[model samples]
Target: MREISLDRLRTLVAIADHGSFAEAARVLNLAPPTVSLHIADLEERVGGLLLSRTRGRVQPSAIGETLIERARRLLADAEQALEDVERQVQGLAGRVRLGASTGVIAQLIPQALETLSQEHAGIDVQVAVLTSQQTLQKLADGSLDIGVIALPQSPVKGLKIKPWRRDPVMAFLPARWACPDIISPAWLAAQPLILNDNSTRLSRQVGEWFATEGPQPTPRIQLNYNDAIKSLVAAGYGATVLPHEASTPAPESRIVMRPLQPSLWRELGIAHRAGEVERSTRHVLEVLWELEAL
Candidate 1:
């Protein structure tokens, strides 16, 4: 059997991702002809055409799609292997890829990272803001070393989960609105509401909260970013429900945050692949756990 080259596999992936040979060449810093040659070499070795070009757009063929999926896993594993070897040889000096939701990234990860940096300057940290579902997918595929995600995540094989923190969901209203110190779900639902969209788990949870109280007013607007929702709320457009961590007031803000009467909370937790862990990854996790303790 003929061996497939990693370089060729990479070229195939770049072309599939970027949608054109020229675009992939630009991203990979290879000549257009060189990119073409790599694909040609791969197709010959695999005995099948890898890509189909149509009307200036390039797409992966059926065989190409299969190869590309496997290639991504291969590349991620190769990169992790290199990082693991480096950590073994040089102590705690390598990259740790961490994934989390926007709220955690905004409120928690930075503080934890600051402490990690002070203690282990040699370790490099990379953070990606992703939904809990996205974070779990990446962790399963070995693209992420650790993920901080909302709790109640569906069981995923090969993942070890642990609690991180819990944040209360608060109602954010215009400061001028006459509201009690503790707001009720019915009151919040009656008011013009700006809500997290259905794309997020928080939105579903919020929807369920409202459902338990019976039929409620529809949201005036739906958005994914907490800051954007806050901006609209500050303008008196509508109220919103957000994690307390993301309810911080800006200097020029006119938003008032209040806890719910029933007190809903979002639970957060960390997940990593089950079994033996890398030293650098474990060190980063220790730092995060310590920060949580404080």
Candidate 2:
């Protein structure tokens, strides 16, 4: 079967966009007869009438509509292919897909990305909010380039894991409510607690902290988002154990954050597939490393 010409496809799209073959020819810098012939060739190849002309305006027929949609995709793909080639030749523009947990995304990723943008304006970073386990799985599956995740994860074959940062877990309470200077697990467990759900590694750590003192206290609410948990705490609904970064003070905020007595900390790390890294991924890693040093 004969393949459709991109030029002819472009002509069809132009005519549809401008609502007339003459207008399309003007925009495309092609003669009106040339544009008409291009459409004729496309229709013959497609084995259907591709357009309907009324007065001076033109509209696509049903088959034309289908081919027009496909044609747009083909054109877009062609353009993207060209752009990718150009970016490769330029040696600085590329896309990197990075995965991390919600807390990392909120607290650290933005600053890292800000540094990345300053250093490499042409590089594009795409972020996915995923659990550490999910991030590891994606990295192994080649879906993600880099992942910022909670460390001390169960060993995964062929992954490069390096410690990133440590953040202290703090007890959050309403500022107006009476609370001790430093919160103990027993004290925290006795309150109406809004805890991180079991899906997060932090939740498991918190659970273990509670388990050390016999029976675990059930939470009044289990939530994943720190911001949402803080909102509830600020409203005097209940208290929560979350990262210290989550408790960043807002002006005249209703919430107060107190350190845990036997300070519990969450360890985060970066993971990537164990192999030769691509230039863009390496660039991102370099930026992250520099940020880590600072």
Candidate 1's residue-wise lDDT over 198-230, tens digit each?
A: 878898888888877777568998877777888
Cα lDDT, all candidates: 0.85, 0.86
Error of 1 at 202 (Å): 1.2
Q: TM-score of predicted model 1?
A: 0.67
Off by over 4 Å in 1: 1-91, 246-253
RMSD of 1: 15.1
**Where does model 2 exceed 4 Å of error?**
1-83, 86-91, 246-252
**What C-alpha lDDT, on a 0 to 100 scale, does residue 4 get in candidate 1?**
88
